[model samples]
Target: MKNVIKTIGIWLYILGCLVVGSVFAQDVHFTQYTATPVYVNPAMSGFHGSNYRAGANFRTQWNAVSTGNTYRTFNMFADFALGKPTYYSNYAGIGINFYSDQAGDLNYSTNKVDLNVAYHFILDNKGTNSISAGIQSGFGMRSIDLTNAVFANQGGGFDPLGGETINRERYAMFDVGMGFLWSYSPNKDRSYYLGTAMHHLNQPELSQFTSIGVSDRMYAKFSVIGGMQVPVGERMHLQPSFIVNRQGPSTEINLSTLVSYSFNREPFDKNSIAFGMMYRGPLDAIALLTRVNLETLAIGFSYDVNISSLSSASRSNGGPEISLVYVGKPKNRGSERYCIPF
Candidate 1:
């Protein structure tokens, strides 16, 4: 009886999510938003003050809920600057981003590829202030495996012979997004930036039951992100950041702060360690994050502890994520430095 109840509960939760997705909007989420810069905003591509940047991220969640009921996502990006920076100058950037996600026992999955471009306008003679405008175009595919799904009409138990019909299992769509950013930096050691983005401007159709005359369109998503870096001492720095996101009737906000200690005096040499904590508003979850910088490469890891109303079902286990980033400078411009590791 206990096993039956647990199975039923899991099914109910999955059903609720599917219903919400069809009626409202659904998008994949990540705890380490800063690590996946292009996903947060197209204007962030190549914003690291380097000649080129490459990054990858992976996340897995709900592993403790049930076997074969987990969710996973993978993302990768590469971006480069078009021109070298002088005291005051304009520049352009281009990038490519790809990501894939899979969730639930039904094997629902999404894959996307995007191309982005941005133009930067120098606002100060010292090149300390700038604005960036960017746009992105992408194609996405969503699929599901209905053969593994369990329906209420299948009785209270599993039965392979239960007959059910699902007309379609996959769909494809085109997507577009745009963003703007404003950055201020007195020098390399201290900086502040703010940006906003709008995604899914086309409201692409996502319904898999097209044969049944059901049409579902994905809602547009809007986001705002901001962060500031402060130098606490010669070797220590503090950074506070926040992100607000809204799609359809759902909304989320995340706040985080990080403290970094550099082992070397040279800012471009890249030898540092940082630790931070993040909170998802309205008691969603608490996360602990850490990063290590070595030369031109940096690696980060974070774990989330569930604290929401669903914690009882999740057993307080949320998710874990890992990220890797590489920032490279041209030989001619080796003296340039970035204000933050992420």
Candidate 2:
């Protein structure tokens, strides 16, 4: 049964890779729930008003299994709101994110750095509704170190000895995305936000492996993101969100819901703490969530309970992730108003 399960899992992973599916479909960590920070839509950059936002996340996955199968990830991003309230008519932000992943004897490791710029233009601001068109430009490089990776030894590395020096390859790609956000309810207790983003407009070429004669292809991904908050009482609220990602031949869907109970009425100094839980589909896992807000600084943590086939081998450690965010409030008048358009 163990071997069968392993085989099935391997096949599923292969199918997921070969089918030209959504790149964002691969689940990595929990902080992705913050939604806005991940650039799920380019238009989200400065949608939250004139505030500087910074965040980071760390995820450790599959620790229950062998050490090699466990995955670790680290991410950081920051964004600034464009324009001043009294002199500006548009909103925009510039953001940069760095990510690194390690798995399977370090054979499957990925390092990426991305710089993105987003802009939002006010379309209409009716009583309580604000609509804007968001656009973003993404620049990044992805690299892999295959020296000690398990996959490199699968076929025979050098010849008879099955040992070959690990080779590293890196590639750079450009991505363009656009998003639309419709926000309603303003400063009310109950609010709703709707957002949609389409990414990888350039169909980034991820073909570092193709240099050895393997066929490689590039695909575009379109994502839809939206969230609604329903207050149960003065102290508690339920928030549900849906994410849809589609590639050329495959589609991945994620649906999650969380509840946050506040103790201090959303903190006046931008600093507070909240505890919550999340249900993520596709992988069918439950995670514990906690967040800290210190004025312009925010941090989040998530630990997953593996419930899928991987759980049997996971030994219950599943995956753990941590994320951090920093929003920079402008002290001067110059740095606060100059936002490069996406």
Candidate 3:
């Protein structure tokens, strides 16, 4: 019975691929710049401070597009500095993240896990130039639940090479990645970061069909992020940021600017709020900004009002998005350590 179930599952996986290849629809992605971090690059694992962090994101695109095609993802990571050049200059840390995405009944879905480790090196006495190298390994599973999907055509009506209706099946696969990060800062507490990462270096086979097909040949991506605080007056400051992403034949860019203020309270508390717009070119079009925040705690949301030609049919409800982030450490709060850089 176990073997029979496995065989059925394999067949379902193949069917899912066929459906996916035929649909050729794009995913509903979020406009929030920080949610899809790891998908952008593995080096992002250590991009934050020497602390652990975690996040999740979900997108519903083309409301007019079938609900089955909506996209959802969840991610989490942890990093920390190690050694002691002066005080933990020999920085090192490890992180893990997971994500699952599905589109339409073509049943194209991926559940992946990543393990990463990185080390930071100081290249100058000025503390402005630093470099980090990181490696990542992980496995993924893809499958289709054909039993619940609504096929384009009734299966009973078809006959030819194979049966019209296939059940559900899943496959487990593995991949590896490596990345490099270069960072610099002209002043204290401000940074400019650049990184590159290559995913699917292992190029694992994903086909469960008799003919054996393959996944995307490979994914090479590059990213650049920079931010600085500008004095706006006595108690207010402005921060601007930009992020660019590329994968295989697709590319995207995100731009944002945030303004913040500081209080004269003890420990010098600080607060900030940011809003910016994004132009995803022909793919996605909209502007978004985040809500205000207190030190170590941040909450923000974004919405993408589609302006594409499809807008006419989508009721101007193209796609809406929301994101929430919390960063901070618990004081005298047990043995758990969090990466909440305020």
- The number of the candidate with the highest lDDT is 1
lDDT of 3 by residue, 191-213 (tens): 45666666667666544353343
Query: Candidate 1: where are CA atoms >4 Å away?
Result: 1-24, 155-165, 266-269, 334-341
lDDT tens per residue, model 1, 219-239: 899999999878889988887
Query: Could you tell me which residue pairs clash in candidate 3?
Result: 9-169, 69-104, 275-289, 328-340
Candidate 3, which segments miss by more than 4 Å at Cα? 1-30, 35-39, 67-69, 83-88, 148-168, 208-229, 261-270, 316-318, 328-342
Between candidates 1 and 3, the TM-score winner: 1
The lDDT per prediction is 0.79, 0.57, 0.54
Using all chains and alpha carbons, the TM-scores for the candidates as numbered come to 0.89, 0.75, 0.73
Output the number of the TM-score-best candidate.
1
* Ordered list by lDDT, greatest first: 1, 2, 3
Which is the better candidate, 1 or 2, if ranked by TM-score?
1
What's the C-alpha lDDT at position 193 in model 2? Answer: 71
